[model samples]
Target chain A: MNRQVLLFYPLLGMILLGLFIGGLAYGAVPIPLDHVVDILLGKGSDKIAWQNIVLQSRLPQAITALLAGASLATSGLLLQTLFRNPLAGPSILGISDGANLGVAAIMLYFGGTLGQFADWPISGYMAVILAAFAGACAILGLIIYFSAKVKNNVMLLIIGIMIGYLASSVISILNYYSSTDRVHAFVMWGLGNFSGVSLEQLPFLGSCTLAGLLLAILLIKPLNALLLGEMYAANLGIHIKRTRILILLCTGILTATTTAFCGPISFIGLAVPHIARLMLGSSNHKMLVPVTVLTGSCIALLCNMLMVVPGSNMILPLNAVTPMLGAPVIIYVIVNRKNIQYFN
Target chain B: MAMKQTSVIKTSDLSIGYTLKGGRKKCVHDALNLSLYPGEVTCLLGLNGAGKSTLLRTLCGFQPPLGGKIELMGKPLSSYSQGSFSRMVGVVLTEKTNAGGITVYELASLGRHPYTGFFGQLRQEDHRIIEESLIAAGIAHKAHNYVSELSDGERQKAMIAKALAQQCPIILLDEPTAFLDVTSRIETMVLLHKLAVEQQKAILLSTHDLDLAIQLGDCLWLQEKGRPMACGTPEDLILGGAFETFFSKEGIVFDPGTGKLHTEAPTVPVGVEGDLTTSYWVGNALIRNGFKPSLVSEEYVSVCCNAPNDLRILFPVGDMRIAESIAEMVSIIVHKS
Candidate 1:
């Protein structure tokens, strides 16, 4: 690693830490910065409301944002590397849309109840989570099957988009048939937010994201080899089919779990990897992967913080705030794509 | 050509082509016998759709063969695992791939992937080998440059350097020089030839540049649609009348005497005499202008070294004409004849 790359890690660390702290301090009820830190350190604030706000509400949201950011960004990076396409992300394969479809089926059709289908009763959140996982995996399996049959990357990508479109149309149909209140609830979920996953739900989301991220880290060598294209990567002893399957599987797990809990947060996966690539100016995957992880966390936290207004409590929808932050970066990257180095 | 030394790779009765999904076989060629020797460059030449690329891909284990056997260094080609197979063969392709923003050193280091550990961190010894490979490929000066920043020729050299870093005994290239400029094409061929001779690495390449292949290839594999491949030394193929039959087309012939391809078949024979060097060019002008020039024929077009700029054209009807330049000479011959 060069001096610049080495220096970038610490800078990213500082930014992530700063944004995380800001996420805790700035909320609907604005708590002082020091009190938020003290409350986090277990020294309770004088106001129990402040204590509950910091330790209970803001803490889970911040951690969820950080983990989701890393997972989504890593997925995006793997897909980008695998397909050699700049635009690939966790949602590109329609895994997130599949999750959305599952949630739609449960929330809209069954009134968010699994009790009618099975003997064992399940909560609304668990039902959504399980259904989303099942939906995402179903689509992931379909994509993997096509991936095995289709030799070309661009063709596989087109097939994935076709599958995504299929899932999305189903979601739209479900939404149209549901009651007004159920439809409103479904639309709220679709709007997306970082605070949806509770303190209790963090364990499942956290472990899965960490495992996916670990698998991604282990995949650095193969991912680097893949940057040269399939022929050379095969010549370099990489099993192209196996590597591709693993990448899709990892991206599926991350996108499904995050979309299930936190809803379908957009563009972090699509934009953060490029942000790291733009900063690092290299795509070796060794540095790009870890840097992508950190950069992802920082940006997600930054976006989460941007949701809360400083003087007042007019919090914006995550979907609205996300596109505002991410679209310009994407446009800049696109317009100046020639100046940026990606695939050789 | 030397049979005593063991062959680097040999195939017997090998058939190559694609097998469709419904068990329908699309056989390109069958009953093929070919051998590649260490310290030699073997060039495969064929018209489009003749399965030259398929053959190259098959030999390197990229495509499965339709029938028969291939032995690599006395071992069955299929027996080696991907890891072991990669150690023995290096492949370079002409197709443009994802040119990622990686430095030349990092790109070259990827050649060590088969040997590297899980994380693929390079050791000091691997670094030394990478440096040597860069030097050998003649891109050592641009070792730090991004792969996307390099020109096509430089990028090709970078890829060759990575293959060199593999330390593989055999290198298979599919039209390695197909996309290069003339100078770079010759440079790449010469570089491969040098590697073959100096490193004793068996090199096999398929190319469309017949002139370079004829000059530099130690052995040539000639393929035509649905026909068995013809393999031999370039000299033997030329002398045994294979070149004439293999590449025969209308208004085109391979001249064995001049060792060049010509696109003209002149009718009336005209003999050439005097300055030997200038006479060669005079003959070229005559053939192109619909007159066959001969060194020892009844009719003659005389060129004198004393007056090198002067050319005298003798017509069959006892008419003689002297022209100042080749263009003027061609004009006079075109109008009168």
Candidate 2:
């Protein structure tokens, strides 16, 4: 490992600490930094409301941001490598759109009654997560099937976009026929909120995202080989079919978990890897994967912080904030297209 | 020359083809048997649509043979795992892959994946192999440069180096020199020849440059229409008139004299005499002027010069002027004779 990368660990650590502290102290109820530290250390005032607000509300939201960032970023890196497309991200395969469609179907067609069924013993967060997983997997499965048939990367990308359009169209129809209350609930979910996931649901979200991350790590070797191309990866002894399936699964899980919790936050999975690649100046995957994960976490944390700027009551939607960060990197990559070499 | 060593690749009545699944199914090519020997360079020669690449892919075990069997080092190609198969045969494909922002060193290290542990960490021996392969391919200096920065020739070298680092017994290259310049083509051929001779690896390559193929390869696999014929030395093939049969067409005769195709031309003047050395140049000049040169005695030159001829001029310039044409020589020859 390079000494510079080793040096980055402490800096990233400090930034994470600062972000965590800032996330706890800078919310709507603006607790003092000392009180925030005391609450974290279990030494704050013995007030139920304060404890609930700090532990349940802000901490879960911040952790959600951190995990979502890492998961989306890792998902983006995997997709980019697997597809051999710089612009490829989680949504490129329509996984997020698939998740959106699932949420829309449940909220609109099944009515807002579906979300209120969280109290049902078997169908609470598990139901929503499963729904999101199935939806994302459906799109991922289609993408994988098409990927096997269509050897061209750009053509596969177009197909993925078309799939996204189809899913969006389906969601639009559901929204059109639904009642006003259902539409209101679906629209709010569409706005994208990291704070929507409760503390009780955090464990499930965290475990699923972690599993996706582990799978992504397991794919590092094949991903590195894939950076050459599928044929080259096959030449390097990677089972292309199995590797593609694993990638789709990982992408499905990561995107599904994020969508289930945060409601299909866009651009993080598509942009963070590019940012990491630009920062690292290499695509070895051994380095790029880890850096992208950390950078995703950092970016997500930053965006979460930005969503609730201090002294401002108006909080921006996380989706709106992500595009503000992600779109410029994409446009820069496009505008300076010739300067960037995609394949050797 | 057949060595007594173990064969790295053997095809037994192998009919290689791709099965296209649609409303109705079809196979690309019928079964064919081919064997690749250790420590030899086998050049596959064929026209554009002769299924040469398809054959190579099938032989490398990327695609299963439509019929028959392919054995790698006496084991069925399909029997080995992908990692073991990769370790047995390294392939350099014709298309440039997605190398993008990867350095030459990183790309070369990927060749060692079959040997690495779970995380694909490089051992010291792996590093040594990578360094040696880089030096062998003459791309050591470009180790840190992104593969995207290398020229087509350099990139090809790097790719070959990656295969070398893999240290496979069989190396299959598809049109290795297809996009290279003349110098790069020669260098790549020479490199492959060296690899076969020194590393003792069996190298199978497909190429359109028949001349270089004939010059460098130890054997030739010529695909004509649906049939494939293997030949020994290029000289033997030529002597056997195999090339004539393969490339025969109107206005194109394979010239035995130059070992190349040349158009047949009409004969020129004859019976001109001079010193053998100067006569060579004089003969070339005569041929350019649509005249043929023939050797005769020094006395016959004067007789022929006096006789009527088309058009002839004497050599050795100013002092010596010999006439050999219908106008002046005819009168002189009639009087002298």
Candidate 3:
């Protein structure tokens, strides 16, 4: 690795650490950094409320941002490479929207009636996560099935868009028929959040994201080969069909898990890879994959900290802050795309 | 005898094309027998839509043949796994590579995918091979430069280096010279010819540059649409009339005497005689002027060899015109005739 590629990991790691500390320290309730560190170390924080805030609430939320950021960024990179489209993101295939549709079905149609859903296996928040996973994987499975039939990546992308459309249509119908309070509940979920995963839910979310990221790492070889296009990649002995399905599966699991807990977090997946590409000056995924993971966590942590409004008790929605960082980066990338070696 | 004993790739009664819906086979050509010997360059020449790409893709194992068998190193093409096949046959495609961000070294390293492990960590031996391949392809100077930073010809040389790095015994390319300028085209052809001889590898390339192909190819495969491909040495094919028949179209015919192609048969016949250099150019002008030039013709045109300036053109009308150049001579012949 050159100087730029070698320096990226540590630089992004430090930035991520600072933002993570900021996320833990500066919430709606102001907790000092030292106390936050003390609480994290299991030392008494001088107040019970601060302890509850630090140990139970902010820690999981910060970790959620970290994991979700990495997962989404990894998915975005995979989709962009798989489809060979620079603008492709986690939500492009409607997998996250599928998760949104699932949440809509739960909040809008079922109204989260624990008694009504008690006949089923899971309940409450668990039901929502399960439903979101089901919905996302359902669309993913559909795409994989069609991927076997459709030889063209652009065609498969169109098929993904159509499936996303179908999922959205169902969500709209569910939203339309619901009561006013239920629609508000569904809309609130649609606004997106990172603090949604509780202390108990972190392990499940963490493992799924870990599995997906590990699979993505294992995929580094084929992904690098794909940079030469499909036919040439096939000539290099990379099995294109198996590799495509594995990529979809990996992107699906990561997107689905994050969307299940985090509510279709936008831009991080689509833009972080480009950000990593810009910083590293290379697209060889060996270093790129790790750099993207670190940069993603940093961006997510930064965005998580920004979601906290200063001085006032008001908190900005996570979605509202991501595009502020993500959109401009994407625009800059688009305008100068020809000059960027990644696009070439 | 050594070439027959050491054929790298041999196809027996091969048929290639697409298989349409409902198991319908849209065969482009069938009953083809071909062999590529080590240390030789075989250039496949054909018209547009002659399925050159299809045949190449089939040979590269990117697609299956509609019928027949391809044997690489005496083993069935189907018997070798993808990894083994890759280690045996290196391929350079017609499309431009999208590996712009990676360095030329990285791009060449991709050719070692079959040999590298899952992470594609290049071993010491692999690195040595890649460097040697780069040097062999004449791209060692730009080894550290980005692929996007290279010129078109350099980029093509880099891609060829990538295929070379595969360390395969047989290298196949489809339209390798299609995107290159005349100089780069000749350079790439010469490089392939050198690789075939120096590396002792069997190299087959499809190209539209017939003049270059004829000059460089050790063997030529002429594929016409829906017809069995013709394969032979360029001299043998030209002598046996395969070249003439394959390229036979309106207003053009293959000239066996010059072993090149020329335009339509002329209306008038004229005799021309001079030194080889002057006579050839003088005859070229006659052919373009719709007049046939031969030594045995009723109407005569002759070049005076001893004239250094103000070259003399003898017309059949018994008038001698002094011309400075072939261009001026042709203009005078048009005006006088």
Q: What is the TM-score of chain B alone in each candidate?
A: 0.92, 0.77, 0.94
Model 1 interface CAPRI class: medium
Alpha-carbon TM-score of each model against the true structure: 0.94, 0.87, 0.94
Query: lDDT per residue, candidate 2, B7-46, as tens digits?
Result: 7787787776667766343445565667788788989987
Cα lDDT tens digits, model 3, A178-244, are 8887877666667778877777778878998999999999999999999888888988999998998
Q: Which residue pairs collide, candidate 3?
A: none
**Residue A330 of model 1, lDDT score:** 85
* CAPRI-style docking class of model 3 based on DockQ: medium
What candidate 1 gets wrong by more than 4 Å, as runs, is A113-127, A141-159, B2-4, B274-277, B296-324
C-alpha displacement of B251 in model 3, angstroms?
Answer: 3.2
C-alpha lDDT of all candidate models, in order: 0.83, 0.79, 0.84
Q: Model 1 over residues B1-337: C-alpha lDDT tens digits?
A: 3454688899999999998999999888888888888899999998888889889889878889999999999988999999999999999987556655889999999999989999999999999999999999999999988898987788888999999999999999989887789999999999999999988999999999998999999999999886668888899999988887777767678777565677865667666776777777877777777777665443544333224477777766566777787777778767765
Sorted by lDDT (best first), the order is 3, 1, 2
Candidate 2 is graded, for docking, as medium
* lDDT tens readout by residue for model 2, A1-344: 36776676677768777887888878767777888888999886566677778888899999999999999999888888877777777777788999888777766786654346334343655666788888888988888788878978789989999999999999999888988888887788887888877777778888999999999888888998887777778988988989988998998899888887788888898889888877777788877888888889888988998898568787988888999998998888778767775533
**How many angstroms is residue A113 displaced in model 3 relative to the true structure, after the best TM-score fit?**
8.0
Q: Whole-model lDDT, candidate 1?
A: 0.83
DockQ, candidate no. 2: 0.54
Write out the backbone clash pairs for model 1. Answer: A343-B99, A343-B100, A344-B98, A344-B99, A344-B100
Query: Which scores greater on lDDT, model 1 or model 2?
Result: 1
